[model samples]
Target: MRNPLSDKVISIEPSGIRKFFDIVSEMKDAISLGVGEPDFDTPWHIRDEGIYSLEKGRTFYTSNAGLKELKVEICKYLKRRVGLDYDYNLETLVTVGGSEAIDLALRAMINPGDEVLIPQPSYVSYLPCTVLADGVPVVIELKAENQFKLTRQELLDGITPKTKILILPFPNNPTGAIMTREELKEIVEVVIEKDIFVITDEIYSELSYSGNHVSIAEFPGMKERTILINGFSKAYAMTGWRLGYAVGPKEIIEQMIKIHQFAIMCAPTTSQYAAVEALKNGDEDVAAMREAYDQRRRFLVNAFKEMKLECFEPFGAFYVFPCIREFGMTSDEFATRLLKEEKVAVVPGTAFGSCGEGFLRISYAYSLENLKLALERINRFVERLRAEKCN
Candidate 1:
């Protein structure tokens, strides 16, 4: 048989976070802080809604754009939470997950050789999805000094004639960074000046610890040019439900819906129903979960500080990016040694991008008990490394 894999597909790397997770899975008594998933179960009310839908025989596929009721709920939620108004009929698309919405958005907008500027360290999917869409992925290395927030200068530097899309991954995954409204205005100015489009991934929007999450789509002249992707996974602990939505200009949403119609048909009907309940009646559930994550976030940051590790205080998301450069080892080496010696798993920063070197992303989505135990093991490992260096 001939070599049959597409070169583009062959060239793409698997997610770095998953690699460590697989190793941790087989190890006995291992504690994994590698994955970004929430530890909380789908809230009872949300799960009950899905169960109710199934019991009522609503298992059939919804319209390709999604159930009208679900879309309305999504719009209402966006308006109530993010302060943005969207047309449920013409400007929204339901997707398999936030991941699929991102892929579809790139597919809908990217032409061959179009450049998509992606900020790092971010979620693992953006670069691969951009490549699969036949777009060039240009990475903007965000600095820890800036709290991993993208700067206007970096945005300006990354733009070129071929640049067509800028991915704003805020309330970032591995680094837990968020861009303030003032910071976004500066970026919006650059985007408008350069005449480029943006795909803002705000899946973690509800998890912002500093304040209410702000969407760039709320800025003047941005809603027309920005594709906003969000879902219930992070917020409602519905990761397995695989429901997400994209809201943007009608022109863009129509194209995304076309791709979604043919490729996915529609999101899971039960999930859509569950999501409706989540949007309508799950605010208290979301608030309660956010509070738990906030507590864990503070605990992990303080733990890292007490260990004398240089950790940037992350105000959003459930992960902490702590610098391990003081140990005179690469991030991958440190993570590997810690996992092997202490049975504690964390993802190396390089998993997100090269700029993540010398850092490790420890997810605090686990319980306080798990986090405390993991931190104890991590502190011990660090001290052992120090003692070895002295010896």
Candidate 2:
């Protein structure tokens, strides 16, 4: 038989994070900090709304863009939380997850060989998605000295005539970095000058520990050129709901919706009703969960410090990117050995990008008790490794 697979699919590696997660799943007594999922359950009120929708026999499909009420609520939530106003009817399209919104946006915007500038040590999806969309993936390796935030110089260096889009993964995964308003202004200047569009993934916006999460879309002239992707998963503890949305200029949103229409039809009808409830009445729930995550974040940062490990202070997302270069092991070697020796699981930084080879991403989304235990095991493992090196 002739070969039938697209070389693109064959060449792309599976998610590196999931490799350890799968092993951890089969091991008893293993504490996994590998996955970036919230430990909290979907708030009672949100779950109740989904059940209520089902009880009312409202399980039919929604419009291609999604339920009008849900889209309205998403717009309202954005306005109230991030201070950006978008037209619900024309500017927003619901997606299966922020993941799908990313894929759709890339497919909608990218012509073959169009260059997509992606910052490294970001969420793992950006590069692969760009490649699958037939765009060239240009990586900007963010530095730890800058707290892994993308720099304007780096942005300029990555751009060329073919550059069409920049994937802004902030409150970044694997390396919890966030771009401030002032910092975003510098980047906006570059984007405007370059005439390139931006796809900003703000899924972790609500989880920010800083004063407030600022969206690039809030910058002047940016809203028109930016595709803002967010979802219920991180903030509302609704990962299983698989619901996300993207908002942008009407023209781009309409094109994305066409792709979404044929590929997904709409986000889950039941989940849409529940998300409306989440946006309207779940502020207190989000606040409480954010508080808990903040506490855990602090604990993990301090624990790493006490162990003499170099962990940058991450203010946005739940993951901490700690430099493990001192141990003189590859990120994969360190993570694999740690999991085997300590029965604890954390993702290797290399899973995010090649630039992450000297680091490890430990998630603090677990309970304080689980985090404490995992920290203890990790400390012991580090001590043993150091001792062996000395001997």
Candidate 3:
């Protein structure tokens, strides 16, 4: 038998987060704050619309570009929520999820061996997708002391003539750091000077605690060069629906559509209909969820403070990355021991990147009772680590 695996695909590591999840799932009394998804169900009104659409026999393949209605609604939603505007007719394309939008953007942009600058301790997909597209991933480590935000100098240092794309993973995963307009402006200056094409993953845009999100697209000369990736998953509790979208220049959208048309004919049709309703009437759902998450965010941050773990308060996403270096354990060893010894499931920070070593990513998407229990167990576990070190 011949092995026909693509070396590029086989070389990449599997999602580090899910491996621990499988082991933790079998534990009798485990509390999982490992996965990065909202605990809320998709809102009733939106779910009803999907059921209605199915009952009405709206089950055929939508246009390769997606339903016109959904794109129009996305246009309206982005403008209302993020203060970033895109022309629905020409600039937007619905995707299977933010994942597909990311792949499509990379495939549409990268030539073989072109370098894509990716900030570390961010999402897992960006680096793999770049490799699969035959693009080289140039990793830029966004450090904790810098609030996990990529600095302008780091961006400038990584650019070369071969640099073809930059994936801006902010309101970031695992760390939850976001850039204010002024902060993004510093990077924007370098972007404009080098004319770097950007893919900004704003999936967590609606979850920001301190203030509103500011899109790089809103910055001068950026709209034409930035592809904005957002979706119904995190914001609307619709992860299973698999509905997300990308908005950018029409030329790029058309190119991405060609790749999407061949690889995936369309995003699921019913999800698109539900998404239209979500766009129209889901602000309240987002606000309510954000408020609850803010409470959990505060609770968990305070827990870490009480435990004396070194961590920065997250701004947007439902995750808190706490440094466990004081425990004298690698992230994997600490997370593994915690799961078996105390039965609390949190992802190792190293799952995000090498820079994520010596930390753990704890999501706050569980019930208050569950969160409290996990916090108690985590505190005990940390004390145990300290006690072990003393011996």
Could you tell which candidate, 2 or 3, scores higher by lDDT?
2
For model 2, how does the per-residue alpha-carbon lDDT over 191-237 read when each residue is reduced to its tens digit? Answer: 99999999999999999998889999999999999999999999999
Over 1-391, each residue of candidate 1 has an lDDT whose tens digit, in order, gives: 9998899899999888887899999999999999888999998888999999999999998899999999999999999887899999999998999999999999999999999999999999999999999999999999989999999999999999999999999999889999999999999999999999999999999999999999999999999999999988899999999989999999999999999988888899999999999999999998999999999998888888888989989989888999999889999999999999999999999999999999999998899999999989999999999999999
Residue pairs that clash (backbone atoms under 3 angstroms), model 2:
none
Model 2 clash count equals 0
- The residue pairs in collision within model 1 are none
**Residue pairs in clash, model 3:** none
Q: For all the candidates, what are their Cα RMSDs to the real structure?
A: 0.7, 0.6, 0.9
Worst 10 residues of 3 by lDDT: 77-86
lDDT of 3 at 91: 92
Task: Arrange candidates by TM-score, descending.
Answer: 2, 1, 3
Give per-residue CA lDDT, model 3, range 1-391, as digits (tens): 9998988778999999998889887879888999988899999999999999999999999989899999999988888766777888789999999999999999999999899999989899988999899999999988889989989999999999998788999899989899988889999999889878999999999889988888888988999999999999999999999989999999999999999999999999999999999989988998999999999999999999999998899998899999999877899998989999999988988888999998889999878889999999999988887888899
